[model samples]
Target: MKKILTLVVLSFTLTMNAFAAQKLDVEVNGLVCDFCAQALEKVFGKKESVKEIDVNLTERYVRITLNEGKEIADEEVKKLIIDAGYDVVKINRVEE
Candidate 1:
Protein backbone atom coordinates (compact mmCIF):
# COMPACT_ATOMS: atom_id res chain seq x y z
CA MET A 1 0.00 0.00 0.00
CA LYS A 2 2.85 2.42 0.86
CA LYS A 3 4.65 1.80 -2.43
CA ILE A 4 1.46 2.22 -4.42
CA LEU A 5 0.72 5.55 -2.74
CA THR A 6 4.20 6.85 -3.43
CA LEU A 7 4.01 5.88 -7.07
CA VAL A 8 0.62 7.52 -7.48
CA VAL A 9 1.87 10.77 -5.88
CA LEU A 10 4.96 10.81 -8.10
CA SER A 11 2.85 10.31 -11.23
CA PHE A 12 0.51 13.11 -10.24
CA THR A 13 3.41 15.50 -9.64
CA LEU A 14 4.91 14.74 -13.04
CA THR A 15 1.58 15.22 -14.80
CA MET A 16 1.04 18.57 -13.12
CA ASN A 17 4.49 19.78 -14.10
CA ALA A 18 4.00 18.74 -17.70
CA PHE A 19 0.81 20.77 -17.89
CA ALA A 20 2.08 23.81 -16.00
CA ALA A 21 5.08 24.72 -18.09
CA GLN A 22 5.05 27.96 -20.10
CA LYS A 23 6.87 29.30 -23.14
CA LEU A 24 7.77 32.87 -24.01
CA ASP A 25 8.64 34.21 -27.43
CA VAL A 26 10.47 37.47 -27.04
CA GLU A 27 11.28 39.45 -30.17
CA VAL A 28 14.33 41.64 -29.85
CA ASN A 29 16.19 44.16 -31.95
CA GLY A 30 19.96 44.78 -32.33
CA LEU A 31 20.85 41.13 -32.55
CA VAL A 32 23.25 41.46 -35.46
CA CYS A 33 25.72 38.69 -34.84
CA ASP A 34 26.46 35.36 -33.26
CA PHE A 35 27.89 37.13 -30.23
CA CYS A 36 24.50 38.59 -29.51
CA ALA A 37 22.90 35.16 -29.52
CA GLN A 38 25.59 33.93 -27.16
CA ALA A 39 24.95 36.87 -24.90
CA LEU A 40 21.23 36.22 -24.63
CA GLU A 41 21.89 32.54 -24.01
CA LYS A 42 24.29 33.35 -21.21
CA VAL A 43 21.85 35.66 -19.49
CA PHE A 44 18.71 33.53 -19.72
CA GLY A 45 20.29 30.09 -19.48
CA LYS A 46 21.56 30.56 -15.94
CA LYS A 47 18.16 30.98 -14.36
CA GLU A 48 16.59 27.99 -12.59
CA SER A 49 13.18 29.04 -13.86
CA VAL A 50 14.33 28.83 -17.48
CA LYS A 51 14.25 25.23 -18.60
CA GLU A 52 15.44 25.99 -22.15
CA ILE A 53 16.39 28.91 -24.42
CA ASP A 54 16.64 29.28 -28.17
CA VAL A 55 18.09 32.45 -29.70
CA ASN A 56 17.56 33.16 -33.38
CA LEU A 57 19.74 35.95 -34.67
CA THR A 58 18.12 36.09 -38.07
CA GLU A 59 14.64 36.37 -36.64
CA ARG A 60 15.84 38.56 -33.77
CA TYR A 61 13.95 36.49 -31.26
CA VAL A 62 14.59 34.51 -28.11
CA ARG A 63 12.37 31.57 -27.21
CA ILE A 64 12.39 30.77 -23.50
CA THR A 65 10.66 27.84 -21.87
CA LEU A 66 10.14 28.25 -18.16
CA ASN A 67 10.15 25.41 -15.67
CA GLU A 68 6.94 24.06 -14.15
CA GLY A 69 4.81 26.73 -12.44
CA LYS A 70 7.52 29.37 -13.01
CA GLU A 71 7.47 32.59 -15.03
CA ILE A 72 9.40 35.70 -15.98
CA ALA A 73 7.41 38.88 -16.04
CA ASP A 74 7.15 41.08 -19.14
CA GLU A 75 8.98 43.96 -17.50
CA GLU A 76 11.85 41.78 -16.37
CA VAL A 77 12.20 40.27 -19.82
CA LYS A 78 12.35 43.68 -21.43
CA LYS A 79 14.79 44.91 -18.83
CA LEU A 80 17.14 42.01 -19.34
CA ILE A 81 17.28 42.55 -23.10
CA ILE A 82 17.74 46.28 -22.74
CA ASP A 83 20.52 45.76 -20.22
CA ALA A 84 22.18 43.42 -22.67
CA GLY A 85 22.24 46.27 -25.20
CA TYR A 86 19.25 45.06 -27.18
CA ASP A 87 15.74 46.42 -27.69
CA VAL A 88 12.60 44.45 -26.88
CA VAL A 89 10.16 44.59 -29.77
CA LYS A 90 7.51 42.33 -28.27
CA ILE A 91 6.86 39.60 -25.73
CA ASN A 92 4.29 36.86 -26.23
CA ARG A 93 3.39 34.47 -23.42
CA VAL A 94 2.53 31.00 -24.72
CA GLU A 95 0.73 28.60 -22.42
CA GLU A 96 0.78 24.94 -23.20
Candidate 2:
Protein backbone atom coordinates (compact mmCIF):
# COMPACT_ATOMS: atom_id res chain seq x y z
CA MET A 1 0.00 0.00 0.00
CA LYS A 2 2.84 2.41 0.83
CA LYS A 3 4.53 1.68 -2.48
CA ILE A 4 1.33 2.43 -4.38
CA LEU A 5 0.85 5.73 -2.53
CA THR A 6 4.42 6.79 -3.29
CA LEU A 7 3.97 5.94 -6.92
CA VAL A 8 0.84 8.01 -7.14
CA VAL A 9 2.50 11.06 -5.59
CA LEU A 10 5.50 10.79 -7.89
CA SER A 11 3.30 10.48 -10.95
CA PHE A 12 1.31 13.53 -9.99
CA THR A 13 4.42 15.64 -9.50
CA LEU A 14 5.84 14.62 -12.85
CA THR A 15 2.58 15.32 -14.61
CA MET A 16 2.32 18.80 -13.10
CA ASN A 17 5.83 19.62 -14.19
CA ALA A 18 5.04 18.50 -17.72
CA PHE A 19 2.06 20.85 -17.94
CA ALA A 20 3.48 23.96 -16.30
CA ALA A 21 3.20 27.10 -18.40
CA GLN A 22 6.26 29.19 -19.26
CA LYS A 23 7.09 32.38 -21.13
CA LEU A 24 10.19 33.78 -22.83
CA ASP A 25 11.09 37.24 -24.07
CA VAL A 26 13.61 37.72 -26.82
CA GLU A 27 15.10 41.03 -27.86
CA VAL A 28 16.08 41.08 -31.51
CA ASN A 29 17.68 43.33 -34.07
CA GLY A 30 16.47 44.23 -37.57
CA LEU A 31 12.79 44.10 -36.69
CA VAL A 32 12.13 47.16 -38.80
CA CYS A 33 8.72 46.52 -40.23
CA ASP A 34 5.41 44.71 -39.84
CA PHE A 35 6.39 42.33 -42.62
CA CYS A 36 9.46 41.32 -40.63
CA ALA A 37 7.27 40.69 -37.60
CA GLN A 38 4.96 38.53 -39.69
CA ALA A 39 7.89 36.49 -40.92
CA LEU A 40 9.01 35.86 -37.36
CA GLU A 41 5.46 35.08 -36.23
CA LYS A 42 5.15 32.56 -39.04
CA VAL A 43 8.36 30.86 -38.04
CA PHE A 44 7.53 30.63 -34.34
CA GLY A 45 3.89 29.79 -34.94
CA LYS A 46 4.86 26.41 -36.34
CA LYS A 47 6.73 25.35 -33.20
CA GLU A 48 4.82 22.92 -31.00
CA SER A 49 6.20 24.46 -27.84
CA VAL A 50 5.06 27.95 -28.79
CA LYS A 51 1.52 28.52 -27.60
CA GLU A 52 1.47 32.22 -28.38
CA ILE A 53 3.77 34.74 -30.08
CA ASP A 54 3.74 38.52 -29.70
CA VAL A 55 6.09 40.62 -31.77
CA ASN A 56 6.65 44.33 -31.22
CA LEU A 57 8.48 45.89 -34.10
CA THR A 58 8.82 49.21 -32.35
CA GLU A 59 10.20 47.56 -29.21
CA ARG A 60 12.32 45.12 -31.20
CA TYR A 61 11.33 42.12 -29.15
CA VAL A 62 9.36 38.90 -29.40
CA ARG A 63 7.43 37.44 -26.49
CA ILE A 64 6.58 33.76 -26.64
CA THR A 65 4.21 31.96 -24.34
CA LEU A 66 5.13 28.30 -24.18
CA ASN A 67 2.63 25.49 -24.08
CA GLU A 68 2.07 23.66 -20.84
CA GLY A 69 5.14 21.59 -19.97
CA LYS A 70 7.03 22.95 -22.95
CA GLU A 71 10.30 24.86 -22.71
CA ILE A 72 12.81 26.04 -25.29
CA ALA A 73 16.54 26.51 -24.89
CA ASP A 74 18.14 29.88 -25.50
CA GLU A 75 20.41 28.52 -28.19
CA GLU A 76 17.48 26.97 -30.01
CA VAL A 77 15.59 30.27 -29.91
CA LYS A 78 18.63 32.09 -31.23
CA LYS A 79 19.07 29.52 -33.96
CA LEU A 80 15.44 29.75 -34.94
CA ILE A 81 15.62 33.52 -35.20
CA ILE A 82 18.79 33.30 -37.22
CA ASP A 83 17.23 30.72 -39.48
CA ALA A 84 14.35 33.11 -40.04
CA GLY A 85 16.82 35.76 -41.21
CA TYR A 86 16.91 37.86 -38.04
CA ASP A 87 19.56 38.66 -35.42
CA VAL A 88 19.01 37.86 -31.76
CA VAL A 89 20.23 40.55 -29.37
CA LYS A 90 19.22 38.77 -26.18
CA ILE A 91 16.95 36.07 -24.82
CA ASN A 92 15.54 35.72 -21.30
CA ARG A 93 12.87 33.84 -19.41
CA VAL A 94 9.81 35.85 -18.45
CA GLU A 95 9.32 35.23 -14.77
CA GLU A 96 5.77 34.48 -13.77
Candidate 3:
Protein backbone atom coordinates (compact mmCIF):
# COMPACT_ATOMS: atom_id res chain seq x y z
CA MET A 1 0.00 0.00 0.00
CA LYS A 2 2.80 2.40 0.88
CA LYS A 3 4.59 1.67 -2.39
CA ILE A 4 1.43 2.32 -4.40
CA LEU A 5 0.88 5.59 -2.58
CA THR A 6 4.42 6.71 -3.32
CA LEU A 7 4.02 5.92 -7.00
CA VAL A 8 0.80 7.85 -7.20
CA VAL A 9 2.38 10.89 -5.61
CA LEU A 10 5.35 10.75 -7.96
CA SER A 11 3.13 10.42 -10.98
CA PHE A 12 1.07 13.43 -9.99
CA THR A 13 4.17 15.52 -9.42
CA LEU A 14 5.61 14.63 -12.81
CA THR A 15 2.36 15.45 -14.59
CA MET A 16 2.19 18.87 -13.00
CA ASN A 17 5.79 19.59 -13.95
CA ALA A 18 5.14 18.62 -17.54
CA PHE A 19 2.22 20.98 -17.79
CA ALA A 20 4.32 23.75 -16.27
CA ALA A 21 6.94 23.39 -19.00
CA GLN A 22 4.50 24.08 -21.83
CA LYS A 23 5.23 26.88 -24.33
CA LEU A 24 3.00 28.96 -26.63
CA ASP A 25 3.19 31.05 -29.84
CA VAL A 26 1.56 34.35 -30.74
CA GLU A 27 0.74 36.31 -33.94
CA VAL A 28 0.60 40.09 -34.31
CA ASN A 29 -0.54 42.57 -36.96
CA GLY A 30 0.23 46.07 -38.30
CA LEU A 31 3.90 45.16 -38.39
CA VAL A 32 4.34 46.31 -41.95
CA CYS A 33 7.71 48.03 -41.59
CA ASP A 34 11.15 47.44 -40.19
CA PHE A 35 10.56 50.12 -37.58
CA CYS A 36 7.48 48.31 -36.38
CA ALA A 37 9.42 45.10 -36.02
CA GLN A 38 12.12 46.85 -34.05
CA ALA A 39 9.53 48.42 -31.80
CA LEU A 40 7.97 45.01 -31.12
CA GLU A 41 11.33 43.53 -30.27
CA LYS A 42 11.91 46.27 -27.79
CA VAL A 43 8.55 45.79 -26.10
CA PHE A 44 8.65 42.00 -25.94
CA GLY A 45 12.28 42.02 -24.93
CA LYS A 46 11.28 43.69 -21.69
CA LYS A 47 9.19 40.68 -20.69
CA GLU A 48 11.10 38.43 -18.33
CA SER A 49 9.41 35.28 -19.66
CA VAL A 50 10.09 36.05 -23.31
CA LYS A 51 12.76 33.62 -24.45
CA GLU A 52 12.63 34.44 -28.16
CA ILE A 53 10.87 36.83 -30.54
CA ASP A 54 10.81 36.41 -34.33
CA VAL A 55 9.16 38.97 -36.58
CA ASN A 56 8.05 38.32 -40.15
CA LEU A 57 7.60 41.59 -41.95
CA THR A 58 5.99 40.19 -45.05
CA GLU A 59 3.45 38.26 -43.03
CA ARG A 60 2.98 41.04 -40.53
CA TYR A 61 3.27 38.60 -37.68
CA VAL A 62 5.41 38.11 -34.61
CA ARG A 63 6.20 34.73 -33.13
CA ILE A 64 7.11 34.80 -29.47
CA THR A 65 8.30 32.08 -27.14
CA LEU A 66 7.98 32.39 -23.42
CA ASN A 67 9.93 30.70 -20.67
CA GLU A 68 8.91 27.17 -19.80
CA GLY A 69 5.54 27.12 -18.04
CA LYS A 70 5.14 30.87 -18.45
CA GLU A 71 2.63 32.54 -20.73
CA ILE A 72 1.42 36.04 -21.52
CA ALA A 73 -2.30 36.32 -22.27
CA ASP A 74 -3.36 37.35 -25.77
CA GLU A 75 -4.91 40.57 -24.55
CA GLU A 76 -1.78 41.42 -22.59
CA VAL A 77 0.48 40.74 -25.53
CA LYS A 78 -1.77 42.76 -27.82
CA LYS A 79 -1.75 45.64 -25.38
CA LEU A 80 2.00 45.62 -25.30
CA ILE A 81 2.28 45.69 -29.06
CA ILE A 82 -0.34 48.40 -29.32
CA ASP A 83 1.44 50.42 -26.67
CA ALA A 84 4.50 50.34 -28.92
CA GLY A 85 2.46 52.07 -31.63
CA TYR A 86 1.46 49.00 -33.58
CA ASP A 87 -1.80 47.05 -34.05
CA VAL A 88 -2.38 43.47 -33.00
CA VAL A 89 -4.91 41.91 -35.30
CA LYS A 90 -4.65 38.36 -34.00
CA ILE A 91 -2.86 36.06 -31.64
CA ASN A 92 -2.35 32.36 -32.29
CA ARG A 93 -0.68 29.59 -30.37
CA VAL A 94 1.86 27.50 -32.19
CA GLU A 95 1.15 23.82 -31.81
CA GLU A 96 3.90 21.31 -31.32
10 residues in a row with least lDDT, candidate 2: 14-23
Better of 1 and 3 by lDDT: 1
lDDT of 3 by residue, 1-96 (tens): 999999999999877875563344455656677888888888889998788888888766788877776777878887888789877776777633
For residue 66, model 3's alpha carbon misses the true position, in angstroms, by 0.8
Alpha-carbon deviation at 25 in model 1, angstroms: 0.4
Candidate number that wins on lDDT, 1 or 2:
2
Off by over 4 Å in 2: 1-18
**Candidate 1 per-residue C-alpha lDDT over 1-96 given as tens digits, one digit per residue, 9 for 90 to 100:** 999999999999888867686999999989999899989889888888899999988787899999887878899889888988999999998877
Q: How close is every model to the real structure, measured as TM-score?
A: 0.77, 0.79, 0.72
TM-score of candidate 1 to 2 decimals: 0.77
Candidate 3 lDDT score at position 11: 100
How does model 2 score by TM-score? Answer: 0.79
The per-prediction tally of clashing pairs is 0, 1, 0
lDDT of each: 0.89, 0.90, 0.77
